[model samples]
Target chain A: MAEKAKILIIGAGKCGRALVELFSKIEKITIIGVVDFNQDAPGIKLAKTLNIPTAVDYREFMNKAGLNCIFNSTGKAQIEEELMLSKPAGVEVIGGCSVNLIQELIKEREKVEQQLKGLAQRRNNVVGNIDAGSTPIIPKMEPPDFNKQVKKDEDFWGKDKLIESIIQNSAVATFVINSQHKVLYWNVACEELTGTKAKDLLGTSGHWKAFYSHQRPCVADIVIDNSFVDLDKFYKVYRGSTLIPNGLHAEDWYSKLGGKDRYIVFDAAPIYDTEGKLIAAIETLQDITERKKAEDELKKAYTRLKEMQNQVIQAEKLNTIGQLASGVAHEVRNPLGIILQGVNYLENKIPAKEGDVFETLTMLKDSVKRADKIINTLLDFSRFTNLDLRPEDINSILESSLSLVRIKFESSNIDIIPEIKKDVPKVLADRNKLEQVFVNIFLNAIQAMPEGGNITIRSYGKKLEGIENGTSRREEGYFMIGEKVVVVEIEDTGVGIPEENLKKVFEPFFTTKGLTGGVGLGLSVTKNIIHMHRGIIYAESRFGHGAKVTVILKIAE
Target chain B: MDRKRILVIDDEENFTKLIKWNLEKTGKYEIRVENSGLLGFSATKEFKPHLILLDILMPDMDGSEVAFQLKCDEDTKDIPIVFLTAVAKKEEVEANSGVIGGHPFIAKPVELEQLIDVIERNAY
Candidate 1:
């Protein structure tokens, strides 16, 4: 149904003979004639064999009927110019320089035609042999089945599209790659996670760009490479490689991705052909960053709960001790009353001339005084049940307490540094009890530095940020966020409490100053008083360095 | 001047008797020791003491309750009472000094001189 192209060759040289041989097999074109100055040219001889007419003068065949194209392969500039002028209107004259191009195109066409004819003949021979009731000759070589190969390629792309759809609709980010590490499938989740489109990544080995700034193999590439070497060099915390049912699995924390660090898991498996040959590899990704954050928060809350449980036990123990001490103190005071009156009577009856007898009576009275003081201290600890809370200036109370200890400081050769911020917020506190707390702390600081040292008191008002809970020294649920509070810090440069004894400092009857005639109820009662005022007190100290006590109280609205 | 008559109300018999002998030895006063609150209340009417020394903690009735009873009585209501108590420390008594709770108090284990000094200053 197609018209043939009429063509002529002006040169009868080797290139011309080759072009004739190449174009003779093309069905769309027919060679009309060949011409050269030599009658014995190789192309002229080849044209005779092919049953084509030959001419010595190319101009003779220039305007020949059915001639639609002319090839000037003479290699003479004069002949090409002459052919260019004399060529007919309907004919296209290709010049001498294009002879090589024409030969190359004709050679390619000849090779394709021969292959097609060979396949056609083999099919006909096989059919003929079948009709003759004979076995067909088994050829030494066989041509490839074009239809079967085309169908196989189509089926592969179809499976690829099916896999791509599955990944595209997945909730987790995923991607797939070929054996050469080329990206074959990058899904919608992958697009959102890596901020890179599938269209940009498909058919390219750029999987590392999503999780790394530099060019390196990802976990999928490692599986394909099957080289487990230097995996830690690539990932932040790789759990090594493990074999799953259909793949190799790897998990790690990747911190170098486009700006966000993420925890990722990957599964990669080698895809094989029907012959069990390796063809490609596929991998999937999952991001667990938010899950990790929730886990850390849970751990912190559980630790706080345990600390609160311990503090409740301690508070209950101290409460029991308090109840017992109160009962015993009241009962013992009456008997102590009788002994003191009897001692007074005896002292009056006995004269100073009685020497050791009167002196011994005085000793008995002194012993009774010491016993009474211990009992009174126990009562003080138990009797602090009610608090008279009022809006009082904490800074003023601190100043008054400091004045009460000024004489002790003068006698002890200690310097007092007061850094009180003016206009400190008033706190809801019992003024008498809070002043007693400060007085006890100041006296302890003086006693700690018997040689000579410095005592620093700092008072200021601030908005509460974070408050620690679950300690006996601080009452939980008493402080809230953004509540205005007054903070007082009493730091002393003296013989600091040792590290082992820091937590026991606020416990009743726990003291480091044994030689000093104290019942060890100073800090214990101070802690109780501050708790009554709905405040917190905690101590910090280094063994050789000084001790610091911080007290926090809510400011009155 | 007539020696001042003093009445001591306390649960401890030995304690009150010792105080009675000690004050009488001074030759400055006459004293009566009542070991129970009900008996002490009746003794104030019969003795008509110039000054009363009341113990805070007592059997059958507390000293504060007995003090309220004496304050209501016509014969003993005018007598200035001094509390002899061991419930408070000696330092606490000296810190408040002189009169507290509308009456004078002497902390227990009081010296003879301190006891007589409070009686002379407060007793009429």
Candidate 2:
């Protein structure tokens, strides 16, 4: 080899940079320098890194000793002319079409090299599989050559198949959609979750069919469209995922999925190409129906526990009030008895005639009676001890209560309607106490309807299903579910209790009635008696639409 | 029928005074009043009353102890004793047929006619 040729490139653009890279590997040519007007050109920066000289002007390398060749890739005719005239004697200048031709050949060689690397990788994989005791199925075909470009394309497509299979066999429900919103991949897990085979949904834009009755964008479609604002319109609970960038996680309850209601949590993210352009979106789904049911059950249990705690507090409060009332009643009654005796003695001394003297004595006597009545009622409310529990007919008790209030009903123009069921089961309750309970309830019903409304007394045997007790004071597990019980419902078309006061009716001294209402201990005593029998009593009212009170007691075995 | 003698025992002096005034006004009975159970037990021996109206809850000595002492004496053992109390409810006395523990009981604050009816029925 006569002396190696020292070449200088006139441009540092893409083509010039490619030529520099290609020539740097040639054995017969030495890169003398790279020249471009812009100091930041790609080819100049690369040449500097390789230890080759770089210049802003081609004339700086023109007189360099033994510089024998010049390649002008700038595509500017003025630069080519200057390079040709100023080149050293016996040096050659190549420009225009010749440089363009060389660049094409260099790109072609790069493509061939990439194909050969892919072939080598495929060969190594096959040998590795053979060593792992797996039979290798080699394709029977002609040997690979540069001209067989389709074979190299087929090899790349084989890698795409591997990705497709991996997604198809995954345990999580997954689907993919192209930029046009067409379904591209609906995997086996998606097929099972939606109860729709993959073939019907593969090429169709029917992903919404799985979750909604009408067509709407799923989370994956929203991600592809970059429409984050639309998430609220579709999902009730959703938030951005912390684990994945540009991904969304959401939970929703679908009324009908695979013929049953299902709660699902899903995550969707956009897939981007190497150029950072959004190409498709992938979404995964998980069925959370069982978990949602368990959560609901836990919440209900917590509410029941709170109610039981309140009941215990209420019982203790009632016991304290009872003891206090008992003591006070004993002290007060003695004085009341003495006053009545004094009044009686005065009545005998006075003449047996109607006069101011006689009226004054009678008024004094009546006042003592009133005070004694209040004391008696208070004592009744606090006394929860003596219960003569026996298996007794609830129907007969209801009838007796109705009879006791019949005079009030007739005087007030109220109508009594008894819908007493025959063959009703007997309840384990004290007869007199149960009678008192019904009488108090009936009296309340009578008082509520001052203008005379219908009082419906209905009694029947029922199996408790846990919903019979509507009061929040109900203790959990007090009555076993499905146990036989006697249900007595007394409904009145009276001035219904205000909604806010419904729960407080059973509380002592909680009365809407004024002083004439007998101290508000009637229902309170009634509730104590019913609770002593291990029964449940609650009231429901619609303010002006009248009220209904239900009482449930265990049926005698 | 001769006027029957009645003895009233109670811790409240006003109550015993009121009972004596009311019961004597009827004219069918003469009344003796004692403010303490111990004094009432002593009064029963001298008063020789046909009936004794005893109050159950007294501070110094209750009616039960007074009745036990009176019954142990041969002179007052045969006299009919009635318990008039404020502690027992009227409904409870009526449910027990106006008698409890072998003695007739009357809830206090009794009207004159009802008190007269009970005294006449139980008096010897």
Candidate 3:
């Protein structure tokens, strides 16, 4: 406001327009000449209306126009040229529109001009505008802790102040946890690394019990089978689990806090105390909820693709087998037809005589029967067989099984005392297979009691130990379990299975009766049948006392 | 009426022997057993058998081809051919309604009476 003269302006963009606006509104200062290459410039016209002279050529105005201070509104690109032209000629180009807008631009230019006067350095103040509530900021200096004197400082507040100094002063996030893995120290950097503030995370257990059922093989995917895995190794969780399956590195673990699903990524490192004790683990939990979701989606897509590939392969195999069936059908049918024709002719020739013709006819018929059996078996195996389950009475099956063993039982003098439980619950089973199982178990029981012993069959929910389905084992759990299942028990008074061998009896190809030339398919088929019905069978044995087998079935009601 | 003659066409020697044994021993007709389709096609013209029992599956020319060639010829066209295949299901035999100019088939490993009955029915 003190020194007034002609101020030259250049460039007619937003910056140029702003300068014209601000300077035009000012009263004393005269914008003597507005110059730009664009002859039809709006600012130039405004300058014309203001009664100031306008020129495209700076050289033309240099002689005619008198200026005290120059404001170069041209731009950064043209600033150096403008300054070189004006500054050597003893002009102050002070006010101009710039990138550093608001009041900082004005102060910065002042500092630049002061440097020419050999003024002392001036720091950039926290500036906006004074009326706009701007304030200058400057921090107080503290004495440096150079000597080792503070190392043994006795004051708790002094130590706290020291630790707080390190936390705020250093760029890294840090924490000092106790031996119990309780978080004691949390820094500002830690809060920034995780969106969680220090207050939310402090004094809480940093050891998270993670439960993920997905087990998808990507990401920093760790499977926690037990309550905990040895957290001895540190993993860099570049990617984490999310709602949407990530194709690669998609970890899907469950959260124990109300069994919610939380997606997080982390960089885990072992934490040690000042005394060098392996106390806790320090980890940064990055809220990768969005990234985890994207990852989970990708992982799910990969799994579905793999499943589709396997299905296609299986379908192709079935197609090839279907093609082969044609040739097989013709080959089988031809021989079958010939046998039929031969059998018909022999029946006509023999006329029921006990001779070569009759014997040959009978053999021919039997051969055809055997061939039919093979074809039927093949058809059954190839066809998808659904269960035709019904509520089959177990005692009826047992009785039929005993009828099959009746002749042998009497001949072998293996006495059987039937102590079958009356009013046993009927099980949902395929009648044929259940009968097969009954015959097998009955025969086994009869064989075990070769020298005549009594068999006790009981149906009760009794104690079974150390098994997941042993609901009846616990005192509080047994009575409530009757609503879930009914147990069938069969105990034989014979030389039982050995302590070491009880578990193997139900497995296929495991039979101790080697002398009887057992094919060992019975128990395996029995076990398969029982499993198909969604039941469980287990055995308890003592070498001399005898073996007791218990089967548990879900009650129909 | 002239006695019937049957030409048994089979690749296997033992099968031919057994058929020849059973048929020729009965003295019911003049029987000739040819071991191959090539030999049987020629024998059909020379033997001039009233009926031909042709085995369908063979190494060289199959029975279907021999039947085809026979029905194509003027001299052997008059003879009735019955395909005797080891692998002719009921549907397969039923499907081959008229294999060679209304000629029928009796499935193979044929019994003594059935073969005799087919011969008797087709006998000229």
Candidate 4:
């Protein structure tokens, strides 16, 4: 019932023997005939036992047989002699030779695949996602079967045979890592990929030990480091002199193996036992050199697109802010002028009733002062746009900010304990901007503890590192201390910002108070200022446990 | 506890004048005004007012710098100074005022009733 190719052979010597054995193994190709001039040809007995047609003469076999294709495995110097003799007799003769027909099958498959890939590449590549050439209209579905997949997956991967089968059959390296990230199981393909045999890698924490520094045995100058950057989604594709980090099951990473740079894509899935415990990640790896190249191209395009989007967003923000600023100036300036005029007007005119005249004047004066303060704040907002970066002492900045709010702190009976470091290294930043950042953070701290609690401000060099967007690769501290940095942490024993509202603090105009909602510009401005100085700011708080904000800045060269 | 005398120091002339007029209208205290920290320091010695209302942002040295100087000097250290600012950020006001020992702050565009109440509560 199945289709098979009927292949006929014209010689039964060493060539015929090779033909009979190789062609018989392939289920798709059936050897119908093996012919030899000698009765005792090496393959003749074997072919006869297998019930295949045997001929002492090629002409007799050609006269009797009907076949799709013929191979003349017999060695020949002049193929022209064989082709003329065979073609005139109405037989198709392959040029007196046999090569792997499997190669032809492979070439045809490759041709089809190449055409498809070209079409896919042209159809707008958004890697790891649906391509644009996909049909716009979706086919109708019956219903959801969430349980069908998650449940049946157990049957697909049987218990005992799971690890062995997945490892042996996978084209990519398969591995199992334990709790301490030690290699538990290393498959044969891992040997093929990393070139270190399974026996060599087993029980040796080589990946954790020397894999980072030692030059790759195969590909020179490839990054030997294979470690993970901790994040919620820690998957990323790597290339360019980088050794694919072990343990992480990201589809693939770049490594130099076999004397040439190659992309080895592998995924490691963590395996767990009952009671919902995290055991180990089962990893699978593959060589996706060409696929990686295409992916990298797509990633580059995506990054460019993201940058363009950020530029557009920032530009829009600036435009809107400019309009708001001008409107505020217009809206407040006219009233300010009116108040000025009114004060001048009141100075000359005497009201008939002297009792309330002084109170009226006082009200007008206070209102005018209030107007002036608003104008000043607006001006300050605009001027901060042009940051005047300089080497600034954070100690002085903190001291100055505290002084501004000292009166209010005392009146409210709040105890302030400043643990500021003596001789704190000066950071390269705008002094005014730094003060503003501290002031904003300090204000939030004070607001948290309304009844007045202990507030601590601590400063040190290299205290914090890897604060998102703030820490650079050139720095370390665990605050991880790879790149040296200076850090200041401010803490307050007040009601902590809620978990839900913590991230919202950095969004402009987002505030908790209904009518008292500040423009919510404080934290946003603080974040922007720190970013401007190439510094990082991070806040940690537990509900009712208070909040701590850490600012990490590089000590300027 | 006769009518307490209150001294108001600020760079804004209209603000000082307004306080002097309003505080005196209460008929509970005598009011005197100075338009600068330097002038205010001088007035403290001459007038010997019971209470001093200070403005933080002023020419010829700011209010906190003035307060720090006052705290250091023997003559004006005894007198209580209250800071009046239009600044909305409590942290800035706290940092500026907290460093100078104990002090009080009130935001401007301040309600006339709240001003009178604060003045009465803190008066000598």
DockQ, per model, reads 0.22, 0.45, 0.12, 0.04
Tens-digit lDDT track of model 2 for A1-557: 34666889989999899989988887767889999998789998889889999999888999999886788989898988777668887676777755775676576557656655776677678789899989885744322443433333233223454456656876778888877777778889888887877788876889898888899999899888988896788998887653345778788998868777889988888876545567778898878799789888988998889877867877787787778777776688788878888888788777775899999988998898888777777767565457777889988887777788789889999888889899998888888889889899988988898888898989999776665447333545558777888888999998898888988898887888897676778898888888788888999999999999998888988
By DockQ, is 2 or 4 better? 2
Model 3 agreement with the true structure over A21-43: per-residue lDDT tens digits = 65776665667677778877877
How many clashes show up in model 1? 0
Winner by DockQ between candidate 4 and candidate 3: 3
Off by more than 4 A, model 1: A1-322, A346-365, A385-400, A403-413, A422-432, A463-485, A498-503, A513-517, A553-557, B68-80, B88-124
Q: Score residue A452 of candidate 1 by CA lDDT.
A: 83
User: What is candidate 4's lDDT per residue for A283-402, written digit by digit as tens?
Assistant: 545576886688789899999898678568755764666556545654554344345445544644565535587678767777776566545444444434546667778888889988
Better structure of 2 and 3 per TM-score:
2
Order the numbered candidates by TM-score, best leading.
Answer: 2, 1, 4, 3
Give lDDT tens digits, candidate 4, residues B1-124.
4788888887767656666665566678788888888888777878887778887777797888877887887887887777766443333444454323357776454444556666766766
Number of the top-ranking candidate, with DockQ as the measure: 2
User: Ten residues in a row with the worst lDDT in model 3 chain A?
Assistant: A241-250
Model 4 misplacement above 4 A: A1-315, A347-355, A384-390, A463-484, A531-534, A554-557, B1-124
Q: What is the Å distance of residue A102 in model 2 from its true position? A: 54
* lDDT of the candidates, in the order given: 0.76, 0.81, 0.58, 0.61
Quality class of the docking in candidate 4, CAPRI style: incorrect
Better of 1 and 4 by DockQ: 1
